[model samples]
Target: MKTNQFLFGLKNLDRGQTMKVAIFANDDMTSNIIFAQLFNMSDIQITGLYIAASPRKGTSSIIGGAISLLRRMAFGYWLFLVFTNGAFKVYEFLTLVFRCSPQTGTFYSLRRAAQLRGVRYRKVADFSSPEIAAELQNSNVDLLIIRVGDILQPKILDIPHYGTWCVHSSLLPSFKGIAGEFHALRTKRAPIGSTVFEVTPSLDEGTPLGQVAIQRDETGSVFQHMVNNNIAAGKLLASMVLQAFQCSAPSFELYTPQSQLKSSYHSWPKPDELKVLHRQRKALITPGEAMRLMLAAFRWG
Candidate 1:
């Protein structure tokens, strides 16, 4: 059933007539690369890019030598984004060259919708944002695709023409929540995948757009899951999102009603719960950070 839904989405793509779309994803690196790939595959142009972790004014004070080092690292990353981002935007521009159903405009104010190609960034929280709506009201957005990391409100969900969607990092209805890797480790599961679907008011419980299973392990770390899931699912979602922008989203495989009976969103395991956790020596910590994170976690015998 799952495979059939995916094939159906592809068939819809093989027949899609228009392709104007936008993307949202939390992992900056994955969003960047996936957009690059989408540029290569379709005539769809990303209107603007918004991250889940929307950047607000904040200070990171790493005094002394660490300041210069951090700045250099940031500068290098920014440079990389510039070159790559420039290329992806070029794809957007070229793709939209012969088309105009998706209105295109550039401005700096509350009277225009924020754009992926635009300098300003927004998140699901921005739907309540008067400034964003004011600026974006006149500009038409056909579809909005989310990648990961941000939870959205219904206000944002109501903005886009076809509504909002995202690609999650786990197989839905099975392992859902804050950290699925640790969840997987505790459950001793071997594989996982990304589920692209509509965003509802529940936790990872939305009807799926699509999903692709992935491989994982007992000795794995968080970053490993992050990179793997995005890479595997990123390209497919990009392609499908473009298709969805052009028409009705094809329904994919859904969780069984029995599986849907699973209840209670679980929190990340606490220090006191280690007695029930699977033990592994894989270093998920640096001596200093581990000590700091667990400072209040240990007690004297």
Candidate 2:
């Protein structure tokens, strides 16, 4: 559905009826952007900020960490290597030379931003912890916004009165797992976008509240495309929350059910699969054609 139609027929929140909102995400640029956008919304009362483990430290074991690093290198650097014939090494060297670690800077900036806003900031080792649940309950949060992290437990999901919502980086039901944007790019699929949905026990299986197709930019890198998708997702999430608050129902019920037949799950690609994906992305339709296909697939409600 188009975002406008999805948000139609809902009133804005009544004055003094702010929705208490807590956000969960890692300290990254995407998270920072999401937080900043939500914080600016007048209807949302920012409650707590839960920072998950950094992607650099996502795994507990060395082997797992190595695997994670390889995945990152494959997704981030491999594409460049394919086109530049490994000359991207000089670009990487120059980046290191200039101390241009954008992710690191974004992490610290997020922390500082939270401090300035006086929001309760917690670095959580486990999202499903009883401690976190208790904290949310005590704070009386009306909504929980998950921008990033692992699947949450039912206890965590049930804390918020309005239930938890997540901004997933893929069109609902389809591409419902890790590296969704990469998977979409690899498949050369159109209507590649983001979904804002109610968080359920199942991963990305909740009813979608809003969705927006991302405009593809062929000139950009994979990382840039992912960031663009995330930003659009975050904005749609904020819009959903605002519209829900305007609803007259005691519990927010503004949602569109996803199709079971159309939905599919994805996982991290294997090394061979990654090579195939790289080849597919390199050989796929141009950005203009991709955008046209995406628009054609976008069915307005």
- Best-performing candidate as measured by TM-score: 2
> What would the per-residue lDDT of candidate 2 be over residues 194-300, giving only the tens digit for each residue?
87777888867777766777776544445556657777776677666766666633232222334422566776555665676556544323455334323322211
lDDT of 2 at 152: 87
Please provide, for model 1 over 1-301, each residue's C-alpha lDDT reduced to its tens digit, 9 standing for 90 to 100.
Answer: 3432332333334354454455655423345443444544445645555544332213222122223333433343333333333333443344345332222221011112233334344543343356544434444555666665445556666666655676665666566664444454455443466667677766577776676766765555443554466566766676566445444445444434434333334444444333334255432323543233233112100
Candidate with the greatest lDDT versus the true structure: 2
Deviation (Å) of 27 in candidate 1:
5.9
Give model 1's TM-score versus the native structure.
0.56
For every model shown, the clashing-pair count is: 12, 0
Candidates in order have lDDT scores of: 0.47, 0.60
Candidate 1 positional error at 80, Å: 23
Tell me the lDDT of model 1 at 166: 67
TM-score between model 2 and native:
0.69
